[model samples]
Target: MFNKWINEPKYFNKEKETIIIESDAKTDFFVAPASDYLAHNAPIYAFDVQGDFTLECKVRPDFKAYYDAGAMMFYVDEKAWIKFAFESTDIGHPAVVSVVTDGASDDANGEKVDSPSIWMKLSKKDKVIGLYFSHDALEWRMVRLFQFDVKNLDKASVGLEAQSPAGLGCKVAFSDIKYTDKAVEDMRKGI
Candidate 1:
């Protein structure tokens, strides 16, 4: 596996098999609509991936503020990317959040998770991308299923991200990292 960072974090380390990233204050990767707001400073460690693949990891975020997250990212440049995150939400809950960016971001908050750490899965097959979360890493629950198309998509970047949009800083730990070249047969089932 190749290690590449889009935006280098303040601190990062590999503890045994786990990757830890410390996000800086007010760092994010969002492009808001109708405003002069664009944040692409959050740290992302990624590698080039082609064809179809599934990447899954167990993430534990030191969530102290709203929107602090540990994320699985599928990136095709700064304007076209997708982030599926286990995020601390504004409503005082930890939730599954997704932001699909095609020039501008379309953010959605999904199921609330009552855990400190959760398993996140991202799978890509053709033009379809699947997002799922799990408690035990066996039975995954669907978070989002959508179609995304971009130029040179087969050579896109697939990896991990750490963001702290509204806080001083956040530290996220990602473990049990697994990647398979084979994509899931069923997007809804995430099999």
Candidate 2:
């Protein structure tokens, strides 16, 4: 029921290839390339998930732009989705743990720490979806929780995205992607 929301996939055509989809602009499909040293954009992948599910992926940023973002995306149209990422402007700058929803951006910038690997785990249970993040694949933090009108989540196809507008062609690598109905209760309690 949600497949119509996604457009054809676009690839980077590099050795560590990645795919980009043109989401329906009318539904909230847009990507912000790095505008300056202060901002880098996040890409969204639209889906219609209404039940308990989990999406996890690995991301490696190639450039050092402020707010350089990479994360698993859960898009409701174009204006709505959840992005969990590690962003920083430079090497000396602390990486911020951030999230954007309903066109509003919030971050745990002061809680910055070193994380070589990042995973975003989104779960839908009882009409509410929880957004969580982790480092070292073990400890997870509850970044936020929200509700959406999603119902046919399982039928949705997740997409991979990377945006490094400032570094023009600065690429991010994504791997080990998995979508399942696995229980994330333990992760939630630790948050």
Candidate 3:
């Protein structure tokens, strides 16, 4: 999955330096911030694992500003999608965890932490989708869960994304991105 998206750098390129998936142990894409909104318009593709699925990755922002955003995204099309990201407020403000769905933005709902290495986990069951974040890998706190209509869920491709609209560059790394089906017994528990 990484190879397919990694090879198509043109589709994910921003106004700054183009991103490339390196051959070493570090699996990340480096992008310079866009002065215009052209970078924000590109959609990150992912294969849909809609039922009881979990997607998680680590992100580090390269700058300190309001729109220095980075996170894993599930895009249903160019216009319909959700992204849970962390954005800093200049250099002195606390970094916020935010969610954008259908082009509307929401405030952060998790606890406060410093320059924290964060992980976002998004799970879907039926029409409801749940978002969670973890400071440590073991425990997860719910951020927000809302309902959305993703037109074509089964054909979607999942991947990570980062954009700095403040004309500064940020690098985001994604690893351990896996999609799996819920166990039959686990599904039966709901009934």
Candidate 4:
């Protein structure tokens, strides 16, 4: 795992390498900072990104409240970021969720998976960003694709994120964390 930035989690065990966060009341990372009500702060365990890179993690989320999720995020700031997660639903089922905030948060919901543990991967090549998820490590599926405006930013932040948008807090275990300085050979292939 890469080193975590100053925005660390609430409770972290260095020996076990476990992270636990107590969600701040009404906290999330969204845009429309001027007038929109969706913006709330969450702990972002960030690491700097370079030219082209790929990062993956296996996350098992304990969904205690609505919208609590384990996420992998790429953030330029509050105004621009990509959050790909498995979010807890009100219907008692979890769904694959991806929210790209480029001024405004475009929250998109993907196919629901039955498993509590999910695998997520994100890659960036120049300005284009790709999001993907997998049931098993062998096969990966695309979640969404978009062009992030920032390019050649030597220190763009990317890392694990946990948020409980509507409730108190949640538990998220992120293991088998993998980070590589090189970009995926082909973004379309999702290698």
Candidate 5:
């Protein structure tokens, strides 16, 4: 089961066959060493994650502004965490982005896709974590493969997130949710 959101969203449910998240305002989670603005205010729909497990969801954002995104997040603390987002890029395209923060957030962007909707997945095997995105749920493309070192990492928060960092807000719908107590065998394999 998941805990209540960090900053509760407009709507949330853990018992549904499918899940949905609708968020408002400029909510985001980031530790920006450059600006001295550690913005960890995004509405996080999270749960305890232990050992080897995979967390995934499908997100469809009414992306109307640059930098707006819906993400799959893993939080160890404000200073150390990760977020994989399906965001509206500055070039006016939807792209996949991965942000890993040890001290300051290292933001990386993947290819710009042609859809407003995408599926994001996170696999945790020990300290290694893989992030992937898919146009459809059947085939997945790797975004980033990395590792993190966190003390008492087990049961650390992992879940769905949404942000409107450069706009008023956006409606992000997340569905087809699954939290499995197993590793995604091949991180590069299709779902």
Candidate 6:
């Protein structure tokens, strides 16, 4: 049900039950407001889903360079999208980072995680979307909650994304992927 969008990855394999994507060198999806530079070359394996839903996955990135991330993406178009990522931050650690892109992207870094992997959840209820991350996939902490106002926000593609913005490349493994055609009742608790 998933297909590649934009740039093709160096390696993509889904036969092992765990999805693995090796992002190519300098692959990313960002529109910087400071320099007004747009980069939308990252590979995304996504499928269109209608109505409100919850998408969850465990992302483990081979964090080799700064800004390298394995993300759960909510995509609308090149100019509008959300990247809820497990990223190797510039602060010398892996952290939860969310980027809400509407023409220009706004980046926010959340909780710092010491683990090799983390579980990410993206829930959509009408025009509002919530992002959450968990250490053990049971207790989740909110990363972002905002309205993604667009023409067809309810009918968008949700998927897995990998980017290596600064390094040559990195492999990202996505496992325990789950999807439900319902919204989370509580946005604050993310359960």
- Candidate 2 residue lDDT tens string, 63-129: 4454444545665544454555545444455353544545443434434556654665666665566
TM-score of each: 0.97, 0.62, 0.65, 0.87, 0.91, 0.96
Q: Please report the candidate that would top TM-score against the real structure.
A: 1
Q: Relative to the true structure, how large is the alpha-carbon lDDT of every model?
A: 0.92, 0.48, 0.50, 0.75, 0.80, 0.90
Query: Which candidate would rank higher by lDDT, 1 or 4?
Result: 1
- Tens-place lDDT digits, model 3, residues 1-191: 43334122222433233232211121122222223222334224345444556566555555444455566766665545566766555545445454544534334434554764576666666656666666665566676656776667655545666555453444554544544554112221211
Collision count of model 3: 7
Can you tell me which runs of candidate 4 are displaced by over 4 Å? 6-8, 14-22, 32-35, 90-92
lDDT of 6 by residue, 50-160 (tens): 889999989999999999999988998888899999999998889999999998999898999999999999999888899999989999999989998976675679889
Q: Give the TM-score of candidate 3.
A: 0.65
The C-alpha RMSD of each candidate to the native structure, in angstroms, is 1.0, 6.5, 7.9, 2.5, 2.0, 1.2
Clash count for each candidate, listed in order shown: 0, 7, 7, 3, 0, 0
lDDT of 3 at 21: 23
> What stretches of model 3 exceed 4 Å from their correct place?
3-39, 42-52, 90-96, 103-111, 176-178, 183-191
Pairs with steric clashes in candidate 6: none
Q: Write the per-residue lDDT of candidate 4 for residues 1-191, one digit (tens) a residue.
A: 45764354555443355554444544466564356566647777777877888988787878888888888888776566788888886667898888887778877778888998888889888888888888886688888777878533566789787778787776678876788977677687568
Give the worst 10-residue stretch by lDDT in candidate 5: 11-20
19-116 in candidate 5: lDDT tens per residue? 66666677787777678767877788888777888988888887878878888888877777888899988876889988998889877778988976
lDDT of 2 at 171: 44
Write the candidate numbers in order of decreasing lDDT: 1, 6, 5, 4, 3, 2
lDDT of 5: 0.80
lDDT of 6 at 5: 62
